[model samples]
Target: MRGLRKVVTVVDEVLRDVGRPVPVPVRRVAVAAVVRNPWAGRGFVTDLQPEVEALAPELARLLTGRLIETLGGVERIEAFGKAAVVGLDGEIEHGGALIHTPYFGNVLRELTEGTSIIVFSDDRLPAGEPLTVPLWHKTAAATRSHYQTVQIRVPDAPRPDELVVIAGAASGPRPHARIGDRRTDPVVRLADLEKLENAR
Candidate 1:
């Protein structure tokens, strides 16, 4: 929180799809924090661990807290993900350094009671560009219904010396998701594939 310049939160609700009413609305939330990139303008520092250790957890806590609050409650969140956008002057690795480590991701998982590895995206960009964070089932990685994304953009952020770190959560799957879970799909061996190809 110390290096933060601003925080933005956005929420989206889908009540219908394809001109049909949804029995239950789908809610998606994204929280983005603009923070000073510790390694910015430092001329290629060799070690990034110290700054990451000092800053990553706090940033994760702050963003994840906002996400949980916006979604009404922790239990309401069934899918989650994270993302980071580094300013133009900073290396893409600077953004990756913050969100890719366990320091940041574990906080999100612990807070939401998620067991699966959290999905993520990272990039380097100038201000006002949109980024999409991918989300998946909190406890099941192959639950295709819960596979989704939330787009976020800060009007003025990551001004060549900052990073836009993001966290996303969804209350449920896409509206009227009919595709079954990945686990339900039948497994095909290499031999079976060859047979099918020959038949074709």
Candidate 2:
């Protein structure tokens, strides 16, 4: 039987090399990709406990690795940081609540403590340079439902730039459903992986 087909989506991708005047040569990067828990897209649940329990730590690593590669490589990630959450909408009951407790801290601790990066969010911009911290649920609290956004800023830019990562994926019963965005890359599916391998 085929294993549960895994579809990896590039929910968002941002690459910037940090170098003075030349973008600051950002060989290191920090990134976050909020995922719709396959079981908890609507809210939280207890039945899918095992799946939800496993996703946070796994996703934290996935995001970190993706960002590192996009910037260059893992060795380039001199400084690192991150954040993880169960849902983008609200506090959960069984599964979501579990994350907010000690187990969730375990995930955060794994993400931020030993790494060169620091990761967190509480409605405030981080307070350091070369930081790759992520803001969780930045979309749900947004007053406008028109778009889902992630804000990135170069140290010298006059204003932070809000990049639209995914449009219709922010909320609702069909949160995981997709439409299209000229600027966004669709999630990577198993078939894409096969094609990539065939090319080699």
Candidate 3:
């Protein structure tokens, strides 16, 4: 069995900054951990559930705090959406891997009436294979990627059952990027996540 290497963890909160008497805030908190490929050189993460579970709340707090601060110290999120991007690197054939949650649809429904979730993977598919996905119930399918990043957004309500996921097989070495500029971390601007998410 191959051992796993926990590499990096990141937390980010994105919100809308509308200048008004009482501005409306839309925020999403994301916490992600990058780990060494277990199967690399002949190993893979055998038990990743525990790590993923432990990461959820911490990410929520970090991202939530940023959201609150952006909205001027708000305590609760009234209307919010959430997402997770997975960066995977590896090589595999057929029936690769997948990333999904049990109640993501329920949460998305609550956040946005007509929410659209997106996933990006850098899988080496056959000529006619699709690279991206909407990640809705009806169109749910496995995604393959390697050292590539896929962004998936789901509409979610203020319920406590919202789930996020990152799945699929990747090839080659994983791609990595620094989260944000140090100056921007203290004071988050729209260019951070909005630009990246929209650009995807």
Candidate 4:
């Protein structure tokens, strides 16, 4: 809370089916916060939970609020993901510590009314580096078209002793997806069985 610095929001939209009878437009919004890395310069600490627990609710509220606002409220949100990038001064574990908590994702799932478990990824990266956060249908994780990813980079952020944590929401799935679900599709199952039989 005390180290909370700045919040940046990015919204991306694409109309893949530009002039078709059924237009397909996908929109995703990402909100990221720059914060002081509590463990920076303090050396390795066995107990990182204290800081993670303390920061989860605060970061969650701020980032989730910004995402909802950027997407103009949450009803349109179809998928969600979270990411944290720690600076050179912090360990990858420090970055992972932020978004890997149950509290962090649970709050997001509740606020967005998303039934499926939230998707997430975190890493330590330099400024201007891209961070790809994978996402899935909020209510149907197995939906093929709903699988998506949001990529963002915070220019001039996480300056050695900082962290850039992001939360993202999407309006819908990819455009004109016909591949079907790999998990339960008949064709996919047949392909898998064929592969197994051929291997044997």
Q: What would the per-residue lDDT of candidate 2 be over residues 4-39, giving only the tens digit for each residue? A: 122222333323313213222222233434333355
Off by over 4 Å in 3: 1-43, 90-200
Instruction: Point out the worst 10-residue segment of candidate 1 by lDDT.
Output: 179-188
* TM-score against truth, every candidate: 0.95, 0.36, 0.29, 0.88
lDDT of 4 by residue, 68-89 (tens): 8777788888888888998988
Candidate 2: worst-modelled 10 consecutive residues by lDDT: 162-171
> In order, what is each prediction's RMSD in angstroms?
1.4, 19.9, 17.6, 3.0
Clashing pairs in 1: none
Task: Give the residue spans of candidate 1 off by over 4 A.
Answer: 189-200
Residue range 67-155, candidate 3, lDDT tens digits: 44443444332223333332223433111222233233333333223233423233332222222322221121111211133233322
Question: Model-by-model lDDT, in order?
Answer: 0.93, 0.33, 0.30, 0.84
Best by TM-score: 1
Sort by TM-score, top down from the best: 1, 4, 2, 3
Candidate 1 residue-wise lDDT, 125-154, digit = tens:
889999999999999988999999999999
- In candidate 1, clashing pairs total 0
Count the clashes in each prediction.
0, 15, 22, 0
- Please report the candidate that would top lDDT against the real structure: 1
